[model samples]
Target: MARNFAHGNYSHTQKKARNTGRTARDQTRRTLSQNFMVDRHAVDLMVKAAAPEGLVLEPGSGEGALTLALAEAGARVVGYEIDPRLAGQLAARTRNDPRIDVIRGDFTAARAPREPFAVVGNIPYSVTSKIVDWCLRAPDLTSATLLTQREYARKRAGDYGRWSLVTVESWPWFSWRLGDTIGRESFRPVPSVDSAILLLRRRPEPLIRGRRSYQELVELGFGGVGGSVRASLRTRYQGVDAALAAAGVPRDAVVGYVHPDQWITLWERLCG
Candidate 1:
């Protein structure tokens, strides 16, 4: 017999009904990422932290785990699922509930409605980068809660990790944080790698306010930075000079605390 999770203070009839539903899905679980959230404690914590005050968007809302919770917590939810089968399941689950809307589409290619919304998702491992980029590009998305591979979450959150180009570029617009570690057993088919949820909140405005030429400056900075770092010069001083010289950054604007990875901030400072 499979282990039974206690749903406290529930009548016998209710417990039986709930378990039956779970059992039915258990057979089809393989088709779903089916990691069907084993950690109720984590679920509660994620829901509490999200506190979706307004419209909330959930991309890759597999089987509606977080989506249903968000709606129950009084949030207005728009969930996008790439799998038609999962979308159908989600529609069935939320048919009686008016607060949730489920759509079937690829998140990267989909045109999200223009609205101020917070995003949350249990992201597919393969497209984590694209999903993060989408959230960053969506100006109206003020915050995001995402589950990703533990290593990626740690690096993005800057924990014991070197600054990356993506980090520097995104830092000006949002803050990244890793909330909790979820064990491998938490999902169906049990992936070998662990996962964690990350919270990101967008800044009210661009880190620098000026002629919208920051992108160009940043591109130039990276080229200079990359060239110097990859150069054969042994000494650190020589590399710095070479990079700055190659970049053509004005001598008067010499930056002392700059790193090769901080292209976004460096460019903004130089432009100012």
Candidate 2:
């Protein structure tokens, strides 16, 4: 008992999702970091949040849990599956659906198209960082809604005073948000850890005009692990003190403690 695959109605869809969640529990593949998304609710939410404006880039399309929902949502989907078996099966299952094209390969190494797109995935935990970087670097990415490890999602969304270099580098252009959580039991194999959804929206008007240089500045500052922001940037760029003053960041502020807006202001003052 799967989705009716007809009207795409709420009850019909939910029934489909519920059935998948109940029956499709499979063992997670460690090499691929596979944790198949069995929860229908999470699938619907991910598809809606990042609703495909054009083509959607989906990696690790395990068991087509999210992929089916994505197609049902009317997205032109390009799903990448690393496992040959899964890829073959996905292609077979979706043979009649013109909206989806299942590609067999490593998505991280695949070049992104120059057209506008969005990314959605129940990401492979091991390569989450790598995948996010690829999406951030995509030329015309509108948004990315991902299902990541709960802890990773929290840290990226800055639920606490923690920020990764990629998150900092991506700050001026994209907004990160924490979405709903999926319990461990939601998957068939039931992972040891729970998962959470993460949303990233690209800014309509970039906070700063130049992207590469802005990222360089942010990395130079956040890359310093053991020193304050001003100290970290002092030797790299002249007038570091002035930039900090302009950004209202304290001379002794920890590099990680500085907010994204502060980084932007400082970069503008120094490089603008």
Against the true structure, whose TM-score is highest? Answer: 2
Clashing pairs in 2: 25-188
Model 2 worst lDDT window (10 residues)? 1-10
Q: Tens-digit lDDT track for model 1 on 151-215? A: 99887787754544566556667778888888877775687798888888987775665424655
| Per-candidate count of clashing residue pairs (backbone under 3 Å) | 2, 1
Candidate 2 residue lDDT tens string, 177-253: 89888888787657799988899989898788888788888877877744888877876788988888888889999
Clashing pairs in 1: 35-187, 35-188
Question: In terms of lDDT, which candidate is strongest?
Answer: 2
Off by over 4 Å in 1: 1-35, 210-213, 224-265
- The Cα error of candidate 2 at residue 226, in Å, is 6.5
- TM per prediction: 0.72, 0.84
Stretches of model 2 off by over 4 angstroms after superposition:
1-28
Question: What is the lDDT, from 0 to 100, of the residue 200 in candidate 2?
Answer: 91
